[model samples]
Target: MYTYTEFDEAFVRNRVAQFRGQVNRRLDGSLTEDEFKPLRLMNGLYLQLHAYMLRVAIPYGTLNSGQMRQLAYLADKWDKGYGHFTTRQNIQYNWPKLGDVPDMLDALADVGMHAIQTSGNTIRNVTADHFAGAAADEIEDPRPVAELLRQWSTDHPEFQFLPRKFKIAVTGSPTDRAVTKAHDIGLRMVRNAAGEPGFEVIVGGGLGRTPMIGKVINEFLPKADLLPYCEAIVATYNLLGRRDNKYKARIKITVHENGLDTFRELVDARFAEIRGEFSGVDQKILAGIEAQFAPPPLRQAETTSFEVRYAADPVFRSWADTNLSAHKSADHAIVTVSIKKQGQTPGDATSDQMRLLADIAATHAYDELRISHEQNVILPHVHKSDLPAIYDALASVELATANVGLVSDIIACPGMDYCALATARSIPVAQTIATRFDELKLEHEIGPLKIKISGCINACGHHHVGHIGILGLDRAGVENYQITLGGDGTETAVIGERTGPGFAYDEIVPAIERLIGAYLNIRQSDDETFIETYRRLGMEPFKDALYGESARSGRAHAA
Candidate 1:
């Protein structure tokens, strides 16, 4: 993880102090809510439907044990006793009092974290693959570049008031664990003919009212040119992007309205003009950031304990099979501690749970931790020998659900439970679905399934990319859910197609169960995942099952 430099520390402290003054003014009634809205939003504060919510940025989703403990402290001392780790890899505190926000910001600054740009129409958190450094398939660790982007984008004057909020994601692997194609700017590390490590720069990809798979603008952007090239892209979007309708303000719409070829030409022209501005200072800073992310030393250890436990304990074996990923070091494994335990709020971790994770990371994970976009806590470099101990500690806290990539392991936003924009309740729906599936004990048999739920069209829950996506909406003042099948957020990214009509809130869970049942029936084998089956059979079989044969045939396809 990158250690904060003096400049970084001072920058955050200054922002906190400024926000404190702004909060005082609002509290004193010197600034009306109208006047204070932008001020508060600039610092990552939001006026939710019920209360003030603060989203603290976790840049590149990398932090240390101490930082994680500080987050727990903020959760307990300021707002609720838990924080919601969001899809952007940040944490959101839902019930903060307005007056207490500055103190919370102060606490965050003390640990080199803040909420700056987390809410504003500025460059949001620059997220990277959670398993960046440790993933066995990585071309390189993408965090250094992500960090460099974070530093560059922070308080950038030109980008401060873009057409809309911008998001960028980076991944160093061929397998897109970071959901790069779903970001406004997706940078995938690749090698040139000379084996030189560079990036395949993608632009205009996003999920929301208008979901789009980003198109590649530059096939191989040299490492030296990344900063300037990105600046050029955002600069181009800032100028050409729509401002009339908020719904069409995203770069995706801009790219769609004006073809990618036209947009690329503009970006290329902008790149030429500003390319000279970057010079080599960015490279020098990146070098320093790269040093901070040097992989933690790993020592070889015997795996007899892990082997014996796997053979003797089915529980531990189940958890291992589902939650663990291969690490670059053969002796190590990437442990994704499931925060989406059955019947709990997905992405939520209590103070005690947070502290335990901090302790676990300190002891076994080289003092490093990661917040995955899938709403899970990751101990990216745990030795295989330490798996049993970590599992037991997690199990004691209800965080040891072996449901990673399983149906019960869901990706859901706070939805109507917290978000003001939510049209229907996502938490309870997710909870019911998870509990129902757990009761049936069909998760293991179902294999890998991505069930993402969004309470609204904003796509905060990322329902657009789930292999099985459920979108909550209000139809005639009633909670209704529309299902989208085969949406995937991967290297092979595809926006899900909506299954005709919508189900009431009561019917949503059973509707999903029926969809899964359809999968089981159509699949050649259990090994054929939900996505694989959907790809093989198209939407007909599932559509037929979802709405019987008559309803399926009568349903008119919407373009």
Candidate 2:
């Protein structure tokens, strides 16, 4: 984890002071709610259904044990005793007092964290792979680069007010866990044909009312020019992106109108001009940043004992099987603390749970934790020998839910409950689906399936990429649900296609159950996962089942 320097420390302290003054003004009527809304939102404070919601930036979803403890403290003392971990690797408190937000910000600042850039139409938090350091096939950990971008983009004067919120994701592993294809700017760390480290830069890929996969602007850009090239891309978007219509203001729209070839030409032209001027500065900053991310010293020890323990403890074995990923070092493993409890909201972690996670991280995980895009916490570098002990502690905290990569482990967005833009509820939908799957006891049997739910077309839940995607919509003042199939959020990413007509809110769970049942019956074998079966058989069967007797009769007659 990158520690905040004196400069960074002071900057955050001053920002807290600044926001405190703004809050005071708003409370005293010196500033109207209309005037204060944007300012408050910019600081991650949102006026929600019944109260204000405060979103805290987790900075590429990496946090130390101490920081995690601080987050727990904030949840316990300020808002409710629980915090919701979001899809972007951040956390949200749904019921924070407007006046207390500054105090909360101060508390976060004390722990080398803040809420800056968590909201509003500016560059949002930069996300990266949760398995960055531990993944076996990574070129290099992407967090250090993500951290560099975080530092440079914080209150970046040039990008303070962009056309709309911009999101950037980086992935070093070929697996694409970061969902880089769906971001405004996606960077895939790659090696050139000549065998040199660089980035395959993709731009204008985004999801919203309109979803488009990013196009590669540069097939290969050297590592040294990473920052400068990114700066140029964002700068181009900043200057040329639309500002008149909020709906059409994103860079994706700009790319859609301009075409990729012309956009590439413009970006190339801009990159050539700015490369020399700030390339040196980027290098200097990255050098400092790299020093911050140097690996912690590890004591080499055997982990064969863990494999033996796994054979003995069924609970530990199931947890180890579902939640653990192999690490680059044979002595260690990546342990994901599942926040997806069977019936609770997929990502809600109580204050006590957060504190326990922090303690667990400090004790057995090298004091490091990461929040995954799938709405789970990760202990990135745990020694395999410590697996049993770590598993025991996490089980005590209710963080040992063995549903990772399973059907009950859902990714969802905060819908009508908190987001003003949302029309229907997403969390409840996810909850119902999870409950239904758990009841069936068919989750593991379904194999690795991704079910993502977005409150609206914005796709905040990344519903567009789920193996079975559900989108919540408000139709004629009634809640309606839309389903999409064949989506995959991985190295072989593909946008899902909408099934038949949208189902009413009450019909959603049954519809999902029917689709899954259809899959089970038609699959070639139990060995085939839902995604694999869907891909092998296509949407005709699933669509036939989903559309009820009408489609069934149509298929029968046609046959």
The best candidate by lDDT is 1
**RMSD list, candidates in order:** 3.0, 2.6
Q: For model 1, where is the 10-residue window of minimal lDDT?
A: 550-559
Q: Please, what are the lDDT tens digits per residue for candidate 2 over residues 362-448? A: 888889999999999998888888888888888887878889998889999989878888989998888888887887778878778
For model 1, how big is the CA root-mean-square deviation?
3.0
Candidate 2 similarity to native, TM-score: 0.97
The true-versus-predicted C-alpha distance at residue 88 of model 2, in Å, is 1.0
Query: What lDDT score belongs to each candidate, Candidate 1 first?
Result: 0.92, 0.87
Q: Distance from true position, residue 143, model 1, in Å?
A: 0.2
Off by over 4 Å in 2: 550-559
Q: TM-scores for all candidates?
A: 0.98, 0.97
lDDT (Cα) of model 1: 0.92
Q: So what's the TM-score on candidate 1?
A: 0.98
Please provide, for model 1 over 384-454, each residue's C-alpha lDDT reduced to its tens digit, 9 standing for 90 to 100. Answer: 99888999999999999999999988999889988889999999999999998888888898899999999
